[model samples]
Target: MTSDISHVRSLTLDEALHENPVGWFQYRLLLMCGLAFMADALEVSLLSFLATCAGADWGLSTAQEASITSVVFGGIICGTMFWGVFADKYGRKMAYLAASTLITVGGILSGASPSYGWLIFFRSVAGFGIGGASVPFDLLAEFLPTSHRGQFLIYIEYFWTIGSMFVAGLAWATLSQQGWRFLA
Candidate 1:
């Protein structure tokens, strides 16, 4: 029989993935997911620095400072639940956009907080956004070939260390002489 492209057999999803070569698209997906993970890590690590500087500036008691952390964690818990369900119902993309919007708005306003109450409120907002960390990770993993999934997932996790280090450097550079708002 003469060769013909029309005779090509359809590959199963697994077969297709295994047969396909890794390329820029996969690499780009990894970069995007890793950055999202890094942002999540940086925001979580920032909790202590913001609380300390704000506490000193505002004369907040130890319990009050601790409350800031508590509220953020609380928001994280709630957001994880809400976003997970939202992702399940609407879509990961929609949930991610909503979460990102919250993070941007909340984090910026956090720096502008004038009182302990406002600080906690904005941190809660950011924490809620941070809770959507799994969305990008899941989205990336779903797109990656099975062979590359584990390695890429691990690489994505390394962004957390990078984020932690980044936050520390930021605090060291500006926390001492700067206003809480500036360091925030």
Candidate 2:
């Protein structure tokens, strides 16, 4: 009986180690989350650049352009709350995937928008995804060990900034010649 118990305990430990696999599993998860974060940041920066082109091309007044930006932010605020609750109830992976999908779809739609109003609507939809994805940052942080959690979280922020810069550069390159529709 004692030998059997020892064998079972050893097997359970082996299984756990295999499941985690030298911390590679966590790293994979982190990479996925980081990519999602990058996408969110890219969408935001692109929207800002596109707003300028949209205003100029559409002959929108300054006030109208400002309103469009405001509407998107407002939608983001609402989305943050909605996503927070959903994240708590559902798993992190599911929430992140859903948010990413929304952002991608919203970005494509926003790029293809013919009018300022349509752009604002799509931007708002993207904002919702951003808001939902934001909650996962905290969840990810919690999953990491104390020694590494802060570093990983900081890396996420860093990646987001990098993504924003990348998008900004792309905007400058594309918008300078072909205009905003090139973004689509």
Candidate 3:
């Protein structure tokens, strides 16, 4: 009986938000979520550059280099399933923040890695954090009015392209001149 009331109340809240005019809340959400998307893309772009640099610096074999890069994908696969469940049990915002933190810590640790083995471990950690894309993709839509949701989602996606370009330029400017550790 009470459960039914809870469900209806939740729907009512969603209804009210949908009816609300487009304003700062929606815009702010767009900015934050877009940044997340951009960061995810940047991290992915950085991987190839970083992996190549690491390979040369560490004198790694082709298979070892590939393994270092491929491990991140494995982590992402596991993290998606893990983070999706985590968001459902906890909340999207919480999961997103946690994932962002993981990405940051993992990235820092990866940059500081002394060997190929450590790099593989840290990159996988970052990849796991990357899997928490649920919040950016799903949460934004829930808050947005149906009329504007499509445009906003599209806007959010544009950041990915920008991030890739930014990384490419950054890599071009620095990777050739500096050591991998500096760029990493």
The global C-alpha lDDT for each of the candidates, from Candidate 1 onward, is 0.84, 0.76, 0.83
**Candidate 1 lDDT tens digits, 22-82:** 7898889888778877878888888878777788888999999999888888988988989
> lDDT, candidate 3, residue 158?
91
lDDT of 3 by residue, 1-184 (tens): 3344554444575678777798998899998888888878877888878878898888998898888779888888988999989988998888888888877777788889977889899999989998886667777887887888899999998999998999888888887777666555
What is the C-alpha local distance difference test score of candidate 3?
A: 0.83
**Which is the winner by lDDT between candidate 1 and candidate 2?**
1
- Which parts of model 2 have CA positions greater than 4 angstroms off? 1-22
Ranking by lDDT: 1, 3, 2
Which 10-residue span in candidate 2 carries the lowest summed lDDT? Answer: 13-22
Error at 54, model 2, angstroms: 0.2
Q: Point out the higher-scoring one by TM-score: 1 or 2.
A: 1
User: Where does candidate 1 clash, by residue pair?
Assistant: none
Model 3 worst lDDT window (10 residues): 1-10
